[model samples]
Target: MPGGRPPSLRTVASWILTHPDALPEKERLKLKSVLAGCPELDALAEHVRSFGQMLTQLRGERLPEWIAAVRADDLPILHTFANGLERDLAAVTAGLSLPWSSGIVEDHVNRIKMIKRQIYGRAGFKLLRKRVLLAS
Candidate 1:
């Protein structure tokens, strides 16, 4: 086989979860071979897909169980992610369960920042606020 640096396990796992059908037949076969060669990668791919499905389906109630499973695994990276989630579990659960999103708020904040930068030295807060209101 032609050789350079091999694909990282994470990259392969992500591909398997998100875009398996997007791969060319040859590449798909290669990925299957690689996965079959590594049981850990296979298990990691399964967990990744499961978590993705949970998020997509807004299954926030299952987050605790999923976090526990991740903690039980030998994967340090996933354990760290689970720990961070535990620190703000309520917010995370709310985000998953609520239909509302912060996208609009974030967009407004970004626009205000852009306006501030454009008028940095030329305008004061009052003018900036006026322009932001008008732009919106």
Candidate 2:
């Protein structure tokens, strides 16, 4: 990232951004001359050219019309409920696989809760630690 060839997509995008005239005469001629001289920049220029064409096409189009077609029948009540529940379960399972699993860490919290219940207001920090480790 610091000292390497710029990524193809980003290089093309930045060139397009800075040079507002996508197919200006001077820029196009420079690209053509560079392409004639160097094969690698030629390939990059070709990609940038295609990307410019796509951007031009996108500028003239309207948003897709499919957004207005989703009715209640497209997503029933029960299916929507199940989809949300599935998302929650996937998030919880992903958290379990992280370097610090909340499940194991929650066990430590459960131990602290037990210690608090047993000690009430009397035990100091040292005795609480002794009780937790010995209990573990």
Candidate 3:
């Protein structure tokens, strides 16, 4: 109420996702009070923390158990997320557990898609190829 605007959605989401010890003292106290005021939010916090641990620890073998726990909660958004993960469960498990990732390849593919969109109606393959090559 004194110095700056309230925290933005991104900042709030980050606070919820980050480990408490990583947050500044002020932000940690604020988050503690907020979670204390709402039991549902408190439960959501626990679930998010558990999921974060699973990701960082490469415990993909716990995917099914995690999904089951999320589904047991009354959280519709997380339930939808769990359902989506179920659709490609094997890939999701592999991605979570493996030490390697296709992230770089995926980023390059995304870059090419953006470049194609930029030149879609304006260029022939020769020009497009030149631009794509130049993009690298």
Candidate 4:
């Protein structure tokens, strides 16, 4: 707030989500200061870090406990997210527990969509089809 610009939302978000051991001293200090100033934020950060661990470690079995912990707190946004997960618990758990991902299929679909948009109004179905096939 004095000599330089404050960190952007993305920067601060990374600091919170990133493992503390990996952070440089300066960024860690900033994160500490921010967390110390707000108990709610500190709690949220702890819960988020735990959730991040669950994701990275493929510990989907911990989801229920995590949801309970989140609901115990006053963080409404996180509560909403947890609620959404509850509605489709099986799919979410399977996604977290499994090593496989549908990302490649999703990416291919996105590429096709992009190619279609790029060729829109510039060509007919034939040209669009050629480009899409070439893109594959």
Best model per lDDT: 4
* TM-scores for every predicted model: 0.76, 0.30, 0.85, 0.88
Candidate 3 Cα lDDT to native: 0.87
User: What is the TM-score (0 to 1) of candidate 2?
Assistant: 0.30
Candidate 1: deviation at residue 55, Å? Answer: 0.9
- Over 4 Å off, model 4: 1-9, 121-123
Clashing pairs in 2: none
Q: How close is candidate 3 to the true structure, as a TM-score?
A: 0.85
List, residue by residue over 68-105, the lDDT tens digit for candidate 4: 99999999999999999999999999888889999999
Query: lDDT tens digits, residues 1-136, model 3?
Result: 2355656667768899999789999999777776786787787888898888889999998999999988888999999999999999999999889999889999999998999999999978998789889999
> Clash number for every model?
0, 0, 0, 0
Question: Comparing 1 and 2 by lDDT, which wins?
Answer: 1
The model with the greater TM-score, 1 or 3, is 3
Misplaced by over 4 Å in model 1 are 1-14, 17-27
- Candidate 4 colliding pairs: none
Sort by lDDT, top down from the best = 4, 3, 1, 2
